[model samples]
Target: MGEHVRAGNLDIWTEQVGRGPEVLLVGGLGDTVESWQFQLDGLADRYRLIAFDNRGAGRTPMPDGPVSVEVMADDAAALLGVLGLAPVHVAGFSGGSIISQELALRHPGLVRSLVLQSTWPVMDPYLRSWARFVRRLVEFAPSERAFLEDFFLDIYTARAHNDGTVDQFIEEVLAFPHKQAPRDTQRFLDAFIDHDTTDRLPGITAPTLVLAGGLDPTARPELCRSVADRIPGARFEILEGEAHQPFQEIPETWNSRVDAFWRELAPVT
Candidate 1:
């Protein structure tokens, strides 16, 4: 079962399962614990997996005013500390990847290893253009559902659309129990625009695995490679046919890749 815990000044909603080495899953913009549901059975068998809703997402109450990547990272660290699950293997997706980078840079001792998927370290022109387009969609869309439908088009691949996966995902979103406040959604969108951790990559000391989808349009594979190059000893790989959210599109491969990385770091018992 999931429960609310006091993390810093916010009541953060979190869920955990399985046992063994801890793995913390941080999700992207508007992603809740449900976003990581596909990994539960695969990863939970060998690790205690924890997933939480970031501030401005899902059940977590958003902080007032503007937010930053550092602020979100602090929230993740605070949540783990309060639950006595620090120094965990941190896996992040998209916006969560940005926060994960900040978490490692600011609280190195709290992160045992890092898995960054569909990530980029800098908000270059291509990304900034998308950010602006997202802002406009959020601001002008007639309704929440309308905004989501339009937004998903840019994130998923053509194959997902052809196979009805996009439709299924939209249904999932529409049926999700907790809805994020529009204002909170905007806060997260704005924070993503300002997030840039390129200069800070060298500070991370964790064993890092950077995964990118060859078909992912948002965080292109080459940009992800740039991130890998900046971090000392970090390895980068591209899932040829996968898109931005590979875990959802190709769970088996995503699970195996992530599990392999963690297993390598596990001590022989």
Candidate 2:
């Protein structure tokens, strides 16, 4: 329910809750730690949960000018260090997944396990093109409606939209502290634009879980499955009737799967 220590040169605004094996959550750009709101409360009793705003986003102050994803990953590790917890379980969504990958790559000893959702090792050709297409909405269609429509069209399965809960979603997004900061937006997008870490997927040391929405054009199940195939002992789960934001789009299914993922690896201590 409060903030954690500053990591390196960054303040690293974060929310830490619960009291078991530490789990750190990272979110996409323009997404605050609060994006995890719906998932945290239920998991709090069993896990020591920490969610934070990445550098250049939300309350985490950017380092003057532009920053790279590598730096962002470092910030995440530093946050963990400050909490006196080493070897954490990590879960990242969208750009957050890239940050987790970078952390696992640079500091393999610090990660006990990994969960990647709605994200690929890097942007595939189609996703790269799609990102470029959506980037246009920043200017041409600045309104939330336009972006929401594009997001729904590009990411969600038809079944996800069947019940009509978008208004609730709109309010949640609006309530977040990260309401459309262009600098953070551009920096975040640029990091994924030409990056391709598929070659390095095999280097990850943690037991991995790759979660992808079946209908998400950006992080298709096939791409995430490919990521899982590369990592030793990694598992892939392709959820039907979901969107890019599956944790929020369908939390019960997400909560159940995530709870199981952790329980399966519950330490023998």
lDDT of 1 by residue, 1-269 (tens): 88899988999999999888999999998899999999877778778999999987888888776598889999999988998977899999999999999999999999999999989988788988997888788879998789988898878888998899998888999898798877777778788886778888988999999999998888899889989999999999999988899999888889988888888998513
Clashes of 2: 0
Model 2: per-residue Cα lDDT over 193-250, one tens digit each: 8877788989998999999887777788877888888899998988876768889878
Query: What total of clashing residue pairs does each candidate reach?
Result: 0, 0
Predicted structure with the largest lDDT when compared to the true one:
1
Candidate closest to the true structure, highest TM-score: 1
Candidate 2 vs. true structure, TM-score: 0.92
C-alpha lDDT of all candidate models, in order: 0.89, 0.80
- All candidates: CA RMSD in angstroms? 1.2, 2.0
